[model samples]
Each structure stands twice: as structure tokens, then as C-alpha cells.
Target chain A: MVVEVRLFASFREGRFKEKELELPEGSSLGDLLAQLEIAQKDAKITIVNGSAVSAEHKLSDHDVIAIFPPIAGG
Target chain B: MAGYAGTFLRINLSTGQIDKESLDLELAAKFIGGRGLASYFLTQEVDPDVEPLDPANKLIVATGPLTGSRAPTGGRYMVVTKSPLSGTIASSNSGGFWGAELKRAGYDFIIIEGKSDKPCYIHINDDTVEIRDAGKYWGKLVGETTDLLLEDTGDPKARVLTIGPAGEKLSLLAAIMNDKYRAAGRSGVGAVMGSKNLKAIVARGTGKLKPAREDECKSVVKNALKKIRENDVTSKGLPTYGTSVLVNVINESGIYPTNNFQESYFPTADKTSGETLAEKYLVRNVACFACPIACGRYSKVGEVEGEGPEYETIWSYGASCGVDDLEAIIKANNWCNEYGLDTISAGATIACAMELCQKGLVDPDEIDGPALEFGSGEAIVEWTRKMGESEGFGAKLALGSARLAEQYGAPELSMSVKKLELPAYDVRGIQGHGLQSATSNRGGCHVRGYLIAPEIIGLPEKLDPLSLEGKAVWVKIFQDLTAVIDSLGLCLFTSFALGADDYRDMFNAIAGQDLTTESLLQAGDRIWNLERMFNLNAGVGPEQDKLPRRLLAEPISSGPCKGHVHRLPELLPEYYKERGWDEKGLPTEEKLAQLEIA
Candidate 1:
């Protein structure tokens, strides 16, 4: 299965802005973060298919994932 | 009186009389300071029905109790007056060194009343005040006016706050530029200043801010500093990328309005995102007076360099106009600053005009400059300059979106609430932020109550953006708390790390007050109701508490948030109930009595 992942702000430093990753069918969001070498604590906002979700949430093929550090402004 | 300079200047521009008066401590305590106190003065002195550009409408520049104090990010001031744009009471806030300098000059605020027969500028040097001739500087761009004013004063250290040609011509979208780039940039406050024939204000102060409880102030300030340093949003995110960091965040969330909100997503948002700006154009990060966050961005695009292209500015000129040319957006941002125009309103207005042209309501032959076409970076940059100068058809664009759309007989095409243009966020997908924008005293504003913080950013805690539960309560609390922060002379960014109790402690220590957290919020609630009352008296009533027709009736055409429309009607009643107002959204007498408004 393949998932599209996007990164923003400082989280993109050294890591790619966006990429597609191959993972097992039963992979969780946490599994994708680990594969990307991102600590669970640093991923303050995690979204799957545009809905915010916890790391333990299940992911499937073609799911769009985005992760960001704690960021805000008006 | 320790936190306050305890004095203010009342200048009658009509008669050239400058009277020095002591601040009323009792009233100051009731209203807090800055926006709250300034609104109190405006409501009392100016008739709500008066034309906003009339000399009868006074421009009150006010600093808060914590302004120039040891509190982190305390350098903020408000330009309060009747708004020509929305016809509601306008209080536009700006962060920069000028507010702190004004406080240091032994004055808490300046009230300029009446109209001057000749162009003039106010010069304040500690105790000395003069209304100097400003004929030579009239009609100049903001940067030139700032430099010319500094030369005339012979004090380069003096801070300059002036209006550019947009204000001089009374463009409804004009902004008051201070420190050359920082702006009290909404509600057409600059037009009010221009209508009074006042061009600029220069201040260079040598006095010091005296905190009432010096020992308590030190400890409280230290605690604030520590929390700010520890917070992720304040200490890292903002300082690292500035507000433009949100471009990707909002775009990914699918609520980023594009092409005047004809769509809710921009595919190439990353091209204009903060990361790209830092990589390509950023010169350095700039900080306001005593600011630790330093979220201000100074960027260069070829030979033109200036502060910002902030999150809203980028969205307005980048995504909102359907233009992904980052360099062109930077140039347009510079044009806005130089011409003293609100970048959000300017870009959003152009976006509105593009839609009108697309629908054939606006004739292409009439444009005469750039084609009113989406994705044209040339249109965005050139239209912005023309709008500021009010040149040719740009004069109609200068009237802002609401007027422009109505003139073309497609009033619904204008993406605005009241007469003010909405910002970057597409409220159709964010319910709470939508409700806040609908009911904002100043129309279509985000900063009044940025529910986007919890809804999208997950600051403090995250709320499901699609959910409708507890949103009214959230909106009320956020709006109230924001009023308190604005009144205290502090930046809203501080609220991400500091809570209501932190603000309470700082106020008590600095102003020598015994305010509990509840009473402190109650004061904010009072300010909120007071503004509502002023708006009501101005004939901008509950009927105006609505989002644009497109937003309320149309769903976002595509994106992750597809088929979602703002649930404003469902939430407005609950909001009114939370605000202790009647069903018509008017404040009840009992609520006013509880808040102790005279």
C-alpha cells in the first residue's frame, strides 16, 4: 500500500516537503512517522484525509497524511 | 497610575489648540486601556450617526496599561474612531515601537478633534507639542513621508506614523502606516485622519515607564518570559517562519479561500508559503519593541525590500487572487506598504473585481491597465498600486469589494461581511470562525476572535473543525479574552502560552489592581458590549451580523472540506444566548447593568 505524506514549517527541514511511502496494509499513522524518523511528540498536528486524527489511527492505501509542528497565526 | 503615563493630549485641529489633560484613573480602570478606553472616549464624544469622514469624528490613538512596560510583547496601540468602511466603531490595532515611544513621552493617548484648514502634522517631544506645517510631505508615499518627517524633526530616532496618498484621497481601504511598515491597517481609519487634514505624528520620548509594584512586576514578567520561551508556538513556530508559516497549514486543511472564495483550495499554495519565502526572499526576522517572538518578516524581492507579506497578505495577494507568482506577491505587498493600503482588503477587493469581470458584470475595456483575469500576477501587482493611488478604474476598486460589487449589480459577488472584505480563511468550512466573523463588531475580521487557533492550529487543544458543539461558548470566550489582551497593550500571540490568570496577574502587579480572573474577563465582556452598543447606535444592527451570501448559501466547490457550508444560522442564537443578548442580538438592560455601563 502507498500513502501520500506532506510536511510543513520546520518539520520539512532536512526531510522532504512531500513524498509517497510504501507501507503494510495495516499500518497506523504512528508507523509512518517512525519510518520517516519523526518522534511522536514532535508531530503536534497530524491529519489523515484532511481530518485530524491520533497516531494510533489506522491508515489505508492512498490516504493523504499531513504533519505539522505546533504552529499558529492570524 | 504607575503603568499609565497619567496624561493625554487633546488637539483641536480646527483651532490649533493642544490641551494637556490628566487621564481619568477611575474610567481607565473600568475600561482597562488601549482599545477599550479609546472606544469609551469615541462613543462618548462622537455622534454615532455622524459621517465617518466628518471632522466631528475624532481619531483617538491610545496605548494600554502594559504598553512600554516589562510585560512581554507589550508594545501595541489602537487607532479608534468611526469607520467609514463598515460604519461600525473601528479600533484597528498595530504592533511596533511607536506605541511604546508614545507612552515613554508622558502621554497615554492623543485625541485629535475637528478639521484643519491646512495640512499639518503633530510633533511630540516629551512635554513639547507642536502642530507643524506638513504641506511639503502631503500626497507622498509612506516611506517618503516617514523619511521627510524624520528630516523635518531633525531627530532620526523619532518614530513616524503617517498616511500615504490613499488616505489623502480618502480611499476606503487606506491604512495608517507607522515605523514605515507597521500599520493600523483596517477599517479605513486612515481616511478619517486624512479627512481631518492631518498628515503625520512624530514622537521621541526620553522618560521611563513606572510600574506600580516594581517587585511584583519583575517576578510576574519573569514568569511570562519563561512561559513564552517554553511555548512551541511563540518560542519556535512564529519566530522561525513568521505568520506566513500558516499558508501550508491552512491550505492543507482545505479552508484556504482562493479566487475570491470561488473555491476553497489553492493547489500551488507552497509556492507562496513561508518556507519558500524564507528560502528565497527573506532578509531577516524583525522584532517590535521589547518583543521576544519577533514574528515580523523583512524580505527582499529584487531591489524592493520591506517588512512582511504576512500570512494574510500572502493569502490575499497569492491564493485569493489565484496568482502563484511569489515574486509578484512580494512586489504587491511592498506596493501596499508604500501606498498605505490594507493588503488583505486590497488583494481581496481585486479578487472580487476579477469575479465580476469573469461574470461579465465588469467590462474588460474599462480596466485599461492589466486584464482583470485570475492567475495574472501582473494584475495583482499593478491593481494594488492603482488602488492605492485611486487611479482610473482603480478608484472604483479603492472603494473596496462591497461597493464595487454593488455598483455592478452583483452585490452577492462581494466576499465580505458588512462592507469590509474578509481575510484568507474560507469560513464555509470552519464553523466557529465563521460565526465569529459574522458577529464581529468590525466586519469580516479574524483577529477579533481567532477561533482558527483551536479549530485548525491545535493550540492549547484541538477542536474538530466540522463539529458545532460548544462553538458559541468558545467564540464568546475567545472574543472576550481578545478584548482584554488588546486593552492591556499586549500582543494576541502571547495568549497561546499565557492564560487568563497570567494576564490577570500582570495587570494586578503593573496597575496595582485587585482583579480576579472572572472580573478581568468581565471587563472584557464590558468592552465587547460597549462596542456592540456603539454599532447599534450607528444603525449597524443585528441584521448586519451575517456572512456574505456566497459563504452562507454556497458550499465549498471542492477540497477535503467539500460540501460544507458555514452553519452560522444554527450557531448565532446560541452565540447571542452566550453573550447574554436578546434573540435580536441586542444586549439586554440586565446584562448591561451587570457590567455596570452608564
Candidate 2:
């Protein structure tokens, strides 16, 4: 299955801001973070299809994912 | 003088008495400086029941130990006064070069008391402090006054803090502007300054700041700067996008307050986002004295050019007003800066009026102005100008949203806390932020306890933004820590890169104290409690610590935050308990005694 993942803030530094990922259908969100070489502790927020979820949650095909480091303004 | 100048400049405008007094070292150690020390003096000197704009009220501008030193983001100062808007303790903070200059002039704080018979300006050149006539500059705009004051003082490098027409008219939302654009912009502090018949303060200094341990301070500053550079949010995102970068991210989160918070999401948000600003009108970036992040934006809109429309201003003039025109938002920002107005209050107030007009509660003809339909950028700009000038429909709008909404028989329509207009974030989605707004010392300000860091952006923690569990615990911590930062005269943005440990090392080196992060935070807790008790004596108690009815009862209608109504009642009790306050939200006698607050 293929999914699109987006990164923001520090996560965008060494890694590409966004990418198309090819993974197994049963892959968990943690599996993708490992592939991106981002430690689970460092990734502050992970949203799948616009809802926050645990990193260990299983992913499905075409599920949009976004990872953001801690960010604040205002 | 190490870290602290330990001098107070007291001026009584009415009696024309000026005195330089010693700053008690014990008091300095207890209260620190900037907001902490200023709040201490305010509670001590100003009578609690005194009218906010009365001559009996005092206005204090203070700098902290880190100010003018090698500390990064040190060009900071704070204005503390009784707010004419909320009738509570007001502490408005700003960043630029003026506070640092004042410190170099050898004073930790300036306490202005009484009112002058005529318009005047305070001129300080090192040791020489004079109250000079300001007839020529009284009515001028902030930019004009700054330029004129520099020429008048014959020191082109002199920095000025001045009020514009809004302040002169005693507008409740008026702001005091410095460095041409930076402002002590919240809680009607400028109105108090205006009430004193004071127009400007010009500062020019030639001196130095001596840290207690110079070598240790230098090394700490270098390490701090390196850490700041290493932080992605501080070094890269902020410098590149400014605060306006939050638009897309916040809008995507479905918590961006739009059109007087009638909606939580706007399809046109991208039109006024940071990404668009950077790609379009951004000219360059600017920084405060000794600042490493340089999050300040320098931009232009057609012929008009100036400093900001940071995220708050963008949300104020753009989403809050139902106008997504970035150019218009920029222009309104320029107008607010030059006119000496608080853009958040002005735009949000006008938005309330716009909503009234939409509901047929206020006829457009009654406003004595054009149609106030949503998305009318022209109306937003024109109404803002009118509010500053105190003309036409702007006259009623100048009273701020709470009063205007009440006059229209719909007080609940105003989105505010303690009569102060809510800023950019619609608290409906961000649970912790909403609670913080309600309990904030100076009404509806976001910076008082910026839970947005954890609530929405997930800074340092990824709590469920919708959860209510353990929020009170974290909010108390954030509030206490923020009080320490504000008192230290360091920009709060540094929290993104540095934590309590970094602050403790720098503070200990400069202030000659062996402080752990725990003790530093205790001072912050003391400061917060002092301000709270001050407000209680001023008649703002737990009742005032509440969100507008619209937020508490009316839930968001669409987007990710849909059907979310603010649930402050469920959290306020816990919050008070966490702060060691009683059920009434007043600090218990034991807590006050424990903190050793007199």
C-alpha cells in the first residue's frame, strides 16, 4: 500500500518535508517513524487523517499522515 | 551594579516632583524585576478601589536584571497599571531597544504618579531627567513622534515610547508604541499614560551593564545562543515565516478562530497565512537587541510598510473580522502601529459590532457609517482608522467589545474574558488555552499563560487537545514559569528552545544567585499570586475569571472542533486547587503565608 506523509518544523530539516511511502498493509505508524529515522519520543504530534493517534496504531492504505515537532506561537 | 541597577525613578506629574530612590536589595531579591517588581509596587502604592484612569493610579515601566546585559532577547520591558478596560491589574510587556536603553541610564524602574496639567514628555539622557513640554508632538502619530523626538533631543539614536490619537482620545484599547512599532499593547496601559497627560518618553544612554560573573555569563550566553540556533522552531521556522506561520497549521488543526469565532475553520485561511506572506510581501527580517531568533517581520503592502501583523494581528484583522485579505490585514496592522491601537482589541471589537450589524441589533445607519458586513476589508480598515481618530462609528467601537455588545443588548456576543477581547485562538478546540484565558490575570490575553504550546502545537508534550485530565496541573506550571520569564525581561519565545535549566544557569550567572529551576519557578509562583490577590482587592475575583457566554454555551458549528463548547466550569475548580487557592479562587491564607507575600 502507498501513503503520503508530511513533516513540519525540525522534522523537515534532514528529512524531506513530504514523501510517498510504500509499506505493508499491516504497518503501524511507528514503523513509518522508524523508516524516517525519527525517534518516537522526538515526534511530538502524529495525526492520521486529521485525528491524533498513538504511534503504535495500525495504518491502512491511502491514510494521510502528518508529523510535527513541538511548535508554538501567539 | 551587577545585574540590577537598584534605583527607582519616581515622577509625580502634578506636583512636578522628581526623585531618584534606592531599590531595596531585599525587595529586588523577592520580586525580581520587570513584571514582578512592577506588580509589587502597584499593589503597594496604588489604592485598590482607585479609578483605573484616575491620577491616584500609578503607571510603572520596569526592566529586569538580564536587560541590557549579554542575555539573548534581553531588550524587553513591561508596563504595569490598573487597566481601564478590565479594572484589574494590567501588566503589558514589549520587546525592542527602549527598555535596555533605560537600564543603561541606571534605573531599574520608572514609577509615574499623578497627572500633569498640560501635555508633557519625559526626557532622560543618562543622569539628566526632565519633564519637557510636548505641545509639538502630543497629537502626532507614533512614527512622527519618534522621528520628531529624536531630532528634538539632538540624539538621532534616542529611542522613544509614544501614544497616538487613540491614546489622546482615551480609547480603552489604546497602546503605547516604541521603536516605531513595538508596543506595550494590552490592557489599556496607554489609556492610563494618556490620563496622566504624558505623551512620550525619550531615552538615550551611554553606559555599560556588568554581570556578576562576566566570564560565566559570556559562556552561558554562547551556549544558549548555540542551543537556540539548533532549535528548528527558533532558528529556522520563526526567522523564515515569522509568527504568521501558525495560520496554516492552526487552521488545519481546526481551532483557528474566524469571524468573531462564529466558525473555527476558514477555507480562505491560506490567503492570509505565513506561507503566503513569505512568498509575497515579506521584505526582510528584524531582531530585538541581543536576540538570536529574530522572529520580527518587516513587510510592505503597496506604499505602506512597517513591522508586523504577526500571527495575532493577522488573525485579528483577517480571520476574526471575516476579512481574509492579507494586504488589508497588513495595512490595518500598519495603521494600528502608527495610530497606537491594540489591533487584537480593535479588530475584535469591530468584529463584534459587525456581528451585531448582521443580527439586525445595530442598524448600519445607526453606526453612522458604511455597511459592516463580514468580509468587508474596507470596513475593517476604515473602522480601525475611525476608532484611532475617535470619529463616527469608531466612537462607539472604541469603547471595546464588552461595552459595545452590552449597549446593543447582547453582552454575550462579545468574545472576551474580564472585558478584554479574545486573541487569535478560539479556545473551543484547544481545551487548556480556553481555561488559561479565563483565569489569566489581565483578562483575555494569551501570553499570560500560553498553554497553546502544549494545547495545540504539542510543544514538549503531545496531550490530547480535547482532554481535560491533568490540564490544571500543566497550566499552573506554564503560568508560573511565564511569570518568571516576563519578570526577567526575556522574550517568552525562548521557551521553545530553552527550558527551566537553561534559564536557571543564565539567571544564576548574571544575578549572583545560586538558583535551581525550582526556586526560580517559586519566585514566579509568588509573583502570580501577588497579582491575583491584587486583582481580588481591585474587585475582580473568581466571577470575573470566566469566558464570554458565547464560548461557554455556543459550540463550534463545523470542522474538527465542531460541537465543542468551552467547559471552563469543569476545570476552574481544579485549576484553583492546583494553585493552592480556595473554592472561591482566592489564594488561601496559608498559601500566601507560605510564599511569604506581604
Candidate 3:
């Protein structure tokens, strides 16, 4: 299976803005975070496709995951 | 008296009479200060039905109790008047050195009544106030006006507040620019100033402000500084990238309005995100007086240097116009600052025009400049200049989106509420924010409540954005609390790290008043109800408390939040109830009595 990952704000430092990575099916969001070397605590806002989800949520083929640090401005 | 300057200035421009009057302490206690107190005076002094640009209209500039104090982000002020755009009570807020200087000048506020016989500007020193001829500075842009005023005053350190050609020509989209780049940037406040034939206000002061309970105030301020330093949003994100950082986060949520809100998602949004801004054109981070967060961005596009292209500005010029050209957006932002136009209204009006042209309502021969088309960087830039200058076809654009769309026979195309253009968020996906926008006292505004903190950023706690459950209650509380923050002369961003209790402590220590959290919020409630009453009396009643038709009827075409329309129908009634208003959205007599406003 393949998943697209999006990073924003400070979370993108020394990392990619967005990219697709090959992963085994049934990988939990936590497992993907670990694979990307991002801490669970640092992923303050996690979105699967377009809905906010928890790290324990499972990922599937072609799922788009977006992770942001604790950030806000308006 | 401890928190405020104890004195205010009443300048009758029509008679050239400058009167120094004592601030009404009892009224300040009830309304807090700045926005709240100013609105109180406006309602009492001016008729609600008066034409907004008539000599009968009053423009009040006021500072909060905390303004120029030791409090964090305390350099704030409010420009309160009836909005020519929304026909609602307008209290546009801004931060910079000008507000703090006004505090030090021993005046809590200034009320400019009647129209001036000729163009003039006010110059204020500690004990000297004069209205001088501004014949040489009449048609200059904001930046040039500020420079010439400072030179004329012969005080290099004095701060200048002025409107540009947009206001001089009475474009409804004009803004009041201060300290070169800062603005009270909504609701056509500048037009009111221009109608008075007022050119600028220059202030230089050396006085100091002292809190009522010096020791307690110091301790509370210390604690607030610590919390602000620890908060990630304040300490890291905003300081690093400014407010533009929200570009990607909001876009990723799929609620970012695109192309006059005909769409909700823009795939190329990253090109205009904060990350791109920092990497491309950032010159430096700027801070207001006594500010620790420093969310202001100073950027340069080639030879031109200016401030901002903030999150809302980026959305208005970039995604809402379907133009992903970041440099073009920056240039347009510069035009707005120079010409004294509200970027959101100017850009959204252009987007509405683009859609009108696309639908054949706007004839090609009618356009005197560049083609009105989405994704045309040239159109966004040139049209903005034209709007500010009120030139040719740009004159139509200066009327703002609601009027422009209505003139073309498609009022539904204007993405506005109560005639004020909506900001960046496509509220269809964010239910609570939608309710807030629909009922905002000054029309489609986000700062009145800022439900985005809890719904999108998960500040205090995250709530499901799409859920309608308990959203009415959330919107009511947020709106009330926000009124308190605005009145106190503090930036709304402080709410991210602080709570009601924190504000209560600060206010008590400064104002020598013991207000419990409940009582403090009641004051906010009082201010909100007063604004509502003014609007109702002005004929903007319950019927105006509605979202645009598209927001209620059309579901987002495609996005992560596709197939969702703002559930305002379910939220409005609940919100009215929570606000202690009757079914028709009028404040109940008993409720007004409880708030001591009756």
C-alpha cells in the first residue's frame, strides 16, 4: 500500500513538505509517525484524508495523512 | 482612573472647537473601555439612522484600560463608528505605537464630530493640541502622508494615523492606516474620517501609566509573560512565520475558501503558504508596543518593501481569486497598504467581479483595464490599484462585492454577510465559526468570536468542526469573552494561552475593581447587547443575522469536507436563545435590565 504524508509549519524542518511513501497495509497512524521519525506528542493535529484522526487510527492504501505542530494564527 | 487617562478630547471639526473633558468613570466601569466605552458614546451621541458619511456621524478613537500598560500585547485601540459598508456598529481594532502614544498623551479617547470646513490634521503633544491645515498632504498615499505629517509636526518620534486616496474618494473599502503600516482595517472607518475632511492624527507623549495595585499587576503580568513564552503558538509559530502560518493548516483542513467560494480546496495552496513566504520574501519579524508574540510580518517583493499579506490577505488575493502567484499577492497587499483599502474586501470584490465577468454579467467593453478573470495575477494587482484610486472600472469595484454583485443582478454571488465580505475560512465546514460570522456585530468578521481556536487549532480542547452539537453555546461564550478582550485593549491572540480568570485578574489589578469571572463576562455580554441594540435601531435586525445564500444552500463541490453546507438554520435559533434574546433575536427587556443597560 502507499500513503501520502503532508507536513506543515515547524514540523517540516529538515523534512519534506509532501511525499508518498510505500508502506505495508493495515499500518496504524502511530506506526507511520514512528516510521517518519515524528513524535506522537509533536503531531498535535493529525488528519486522515480530510478528517482529524488519532494516531491509533489505521491507514489504508492511498490515504493522505497531514500532521501539524501545535500552531494557530488568524 | 488608575487604568484610564481620566481625560478625553472632543474635537468638533465643524466648529473647530477642541474641548477637554473628563472621562465618565462610571460608564467606563460598566463597559470596560476602548471598544465597549467608545460604542457607548457613539450610540448616545449619534442617531442610528444618520447617513454614515454625514456630518452627524461621529468617529471615536479609544484605548482600553490595559493599553500602554505593562500588560502583554497592550498597545491596542478601537475605531468605533457606524459602518458605511455593513450599516452596523463598527469597532475596528489595531495594534501599533499610535495607541500607546494616545494613552501617554493623557487622553483615553477622541471624538471627532461634524465635518471639517476644509482638509485638516490633528497634532497632539502632552499639553498642546492643534488642528492644522493639510492642503499639501490631501491626495498622498498612506506612507507618504505619514512621512509628511511627521515632518510637519517636527517630531520624528511622533506616530501618524492617516487614510489614503481610497478614503479621500469615499470608497467604501477604505481603511485607517497608522504607524506607517498598522490599520484599523475594516467597515469603511476611513470613509467616515475622510468625510470629516480629516487627514491625519499625530501624537507625541512622554507621560507614564501606573496600575492601581502596582504589586498585584506586576505579578499577574509576570505570570502572563511566562504562559505566553511557553505557548507554542505564541513562542514559536507566530514569532517564526507570523499569522501567515495558518495558510497550510487551514488549507489542509479543506475549509479554505477558493475562487469566490465556488470551491473549498486549492491544490496549489502550498505555493502561497507561510513556509513559502519565509523561504522567499521575509525581511524581518515586527512587533507592536510591549508585544512578546510579534506576529507581524515585514516582507519585500523585489524593490518594494512593506508589511503583511497576512493569512486573511493571502486567502483573499490568492485562493479566493484563484491566483497562486505569491509575489503578485504581495504587490497587491502593498497597494492596499499604500491606498488605504481593506485587503479582504478589495480582493473579494474583485473575485466577485471575476465571477460576474465569467457569467457574462460584466461586459468586456465595460472593463477599462486588465481582464477580470480568476488566476490572472495582473488583474488582481491592477484592479486593486484602480479600486484604491477609484479609477474607471475600478470605481465599480470600490463599491465592494455586495453592491457590485447586486448591480450586475446576481446578489447571490457576493460571499458576504450583512454586506461585509467574509474572511478566509469557508464556514460551511466549520459550523461554530459559521454561526459566529452570521451574527458578528460588524457583519462577516472572524475576530468577534474566533471559534477557529477550539474547532481548528484545538487550543483549550478540540471540537469536531462539522458537528452542530453544543456549537451555539460555544459561539455565545466565545463572542462574549472576545468582547471583553477587545475592550481591555489586549490582542485576541492572548486567549490561546490565557483564560477568563487570567483576564479578570489583570483587569482587577489595573482598574482597582474586584470583578469575578462571571461579572467580567457579564460586562462583555452588556457590550454585545448594546451593539446589537444599535444595529437593531439602525434597521439591521434579525433578518440580517444570516449567512450568504450559497453558504446555506450549496455544498462544497470537492474537498475533504465535500458535501457539507453550513447548518446555520439549526444554529441561529439556538444562538439567539443562548444570548438571552427572544425568538426574533431582540434582547429581552429583562435581560437588558439584568445587564444594567435598561
Cα miss at B440, model 1 (Å)? 0.4
What is the CAPRI rating of model 2's predicted complex? acceptable
Ranked by lDDT, the better of candidates 1 and 2 is 1
Cα lDDT tens digits, model 1, B445-558, are: 999999999999886689988889999999999999999999999999999899999999999999999999999999999999999999999999999999998888888899
Output the TM-score of candidate 2: 0.95
Per-residue error for B406 in candidate 3, Å, reads 0.5
Fnat of candidates, each listed: 0.75, 0.34, 0.80
Error of 1 at B50 (Å): 0.6
lDDT of 3 by residue, B64-171 (tens): 999999999999999999999989999999999999999999999999999889999999998799998988999999999998888877889998999999999999
Q: Which stretches of candidate 1 lie above 4 Å from their native place? A: none
Task: Please compute and give the TM-score of the first chain of candidate 1 against the native first chain.
Answer: 0.95
Whole-model lDDT values for every prediction: 0.93, 0.88, 0.93
lDDT of 1 at B14: 99
Docking model 3 quality class: high
Q: Can you rank all candidates by DockQ, best first?
A: 3, 1, 2
